[model samples]
Target: MASAGMRRRVEAIPGRPLPYGILGGCTEVIDVEDEHELLGVEWMALGCCPVEVWNDPCVGADESPGAPAKKQFCRPTIEHADPITVYAGAECGTMGWSYAEARQHAEASLDLGQQEAVELGFWTNHLAATATDLTPAEGPVDIAQGVAALEGCLAEQYGGVGVLHVPAGAAALLGCCNVVQRDPGGGPPTTLAGNCAVIGAGYSTANTGPGGIPADPGTAWLYITGPVVVRRGPAMTVPDRPGPSINYRTNTQRVLVERTYVVATTCTVCAVAVTTCPS
Candidate 1:
């Protein structure tokens, strides 16, 4: 997405939700603690057809008229929906930047939090596919096969292949075999392995579970498809209260970034876990 990142400037309209329809939800606010925000929240409940079908080839439509009264009542279930939720990041603060320099410094500080949020979302929503289970041994080839297996599992859930969000270390291994490809048009980088498209991102290796896997020594590929809902609130900057001008106090400016999102695979199942043992 480098080309898009460089050439296109996309910004959400302030005070409104930015809907990235890659996931299967909309208008769902997951991080709200208020009881009123939780009221009436619901998800689709798939129903079955009550009428039985005649399997006999000789049965004519008139002779095998199924129950005319049979009906399928499919509705949204109003309950506590388990949308894969990600909590808001802690408020980051910086002190002593001049008034003119505050905004730039604050923006730079926000980078780490934003990366953490991405990592958290990936960790929360991914489905793990490790080397021991998918392949005979650990290596780039095994990880590639793992990617294939993970994509299959993902397709079974959502009936289509998902993209591979790859870590840098894994990408290096996959790249050795020419499995990873750069976007010729300068878009976001992606790798095409088997039926899945892989993307190398900073968030892929965050919190690799109990093994404490880091990006380079281990292999982890997050395969995601189906509906993924990401809701991002705009970043706001303001003067720290007990203001510098109000009191002869420390000159500090605060940048508040509020982001709450549910990175989940709705009923269709969005993500699958794929991993490899340390290299």
Candidate 2:
């Protein structure tokens, strides 16, 4: 028999460590996918407005001042937001978990939201492999040849600065080009012939056409005179608040957390799609 004080001390002694038989885990989470970036021509945020309209300006030979200015009528170009919502959530038993785990979940949810925006930007602008039609290229693309093809189209259309969005496979070929390679000795960086910027996109893919028909993967290379514009509409308004918000729910004594936002993508006429290339 133990004394009263001794019994209290024994009782206070901690039992098995928390989570019983579970082992400790590393704090770091490995990310296998390439992070998405805003690679297109441009980005703009329009709050509350559902549509934007602009008048197309003419660019060509100017008419003689005295010759009665030609009745120049410009067409209005309109861009509308196609709102999309993306969200992520997690639930854990109302008990044991460190704040570290909660932080990880929050970070992952944010990443998913941004990734959705990137994919929308990439697919919004539809382009054809050739000037003739919407058909994509049939096979692997020769980087040099492919670039040249794109240059021709750019010159024919809107010819200022251009950007190329290439998938992993196309990027590999582009990487082998002299333009992308750095000089062994200190020298000026080689420039792509047309003063174009090449961006490698991890999210590039062979998008499906109407009725689920697979389009060409090579069409992944998008040529644009400007940046892809990602617009944020009225933040998904929650009932209680006037802006985007995260809500919580309780189920089976567990808490579920979720967040959401509304976003859209727009492309200008300056963007051209190049589908014929190696996957």
Candidate 3:
């Protein structure tokens, strides 16, 4: 039979659903077991360079090529460790909670932290660099107008496979549009437009404002792009002590969980298009 403490630990695991699926779909995850790794860089040539005319036959064909040169680069990856600690008093342990339960909480907390970090990185680094401002004129955005503008932006910069990411507010607006369908199992509406799939969750315009402060509540940001490449390096877990150590004097037991990983994007073309709609 399981002890009361063991039962408590099992019960402590929360039933709350996580947002892991959303993260998995939106970004490419590269898992590593080491502290750091190197990621290769490849990009398309911006344009063709003008060809030079050589008067001398001895100038050689190599010296007068009419095409632009293309090159690739590499970058070293750096790892960041995020750690969280949780403690349960000795009295609480006696009441049925165990050190294992505390560890479970710590792990869950770290997982959520990692997800947040990835989301923030995508927004600040990738999306911010290649965004198109589409602030509306004194009213909520019209779905048709918004879709047209998004298509135009993609056509102008990148007209390849893409996905649309919007915050809850913007998603709600999109859901009400006649062009959007609630069921993915069903065929898309006949009037549906654009080449990107819509994901109404896993995004926020908050903390994207100047100085990292939260943006206006009415502000909404949308993203359209090819796959987002995320590279992850080795994740290590370190405990504060080798085994469960109890401090009788303080009547408390504690554990610390440390995790290290690396993540970055490696998209060559205009991988992401940002659209900002104002309230």
* Prediction RMSDs, each to the true structure: 10.6, 14.8, 9.3
Candidate 2: where are CA atoms >4 Å away? 1-76, 98-100, 120-140, 179-202, 205-225, 232-279
Instruction: Give Cα-based local distance difference scores for all models.
Output: 0.40, 0.36, 0.44
TM-score of 1: 0.51
Better TM-score candidate (2, 3): 3
Per-residue C-alpha lDDT of model 1 across residues 1-279, encoded as one tens digit per residue? 366546855543333111111221212324445434322234453321123454654445576666654434544443223322223222223443444444444545554344444444544444332221232334333555655565565555445333544554455555554655655655434446333343333344362422334334444534444333344444444444324412234333444333334343333322323445543
Arrange candidates, best lDDT first: 3, 1, 2
Q: Which residue runs of candidate 1 sit more than 4 Å off their true CA positions?
A: 1-96, 111-116, 125-141, 176-180, 189-221, 238-255, 267-279
lDDT of 2 by residue, 1-279 (tens): 877766532222222321100010101112213223211122342221223344333435356434433434434444443333444444344345333444445445544444433343333424222122222356424556555665565445544443443434444455555534433564322236434343323224433332224445445343333223333322221222211222235321212233222222223222223444444
TM-score against truth, every candidate: 0.51, 0.46, 0.55
Tell me the tens digit of each residue's lDDT in model 3 across 1-279. 987767642344444323322344445555544433423233442311223443654355576677654454435334222321222222234224467665665556555555544455455555555555553555335555665565555555544444454554455456454544443645322225434343422345333532333445555555555434455544333344425545566656555554433333222222222234532
Clashing pairs in 3: 32-234, 33-234, 34-234
- Model 2 lDDT on a 0 to 1 scale: 0.36
Give candidate 3 misplaced runs (Cα > 4 Å).
1-10, 13-22, 33-35, 38-98, 136-140, 178-202, 205-213, 240-279
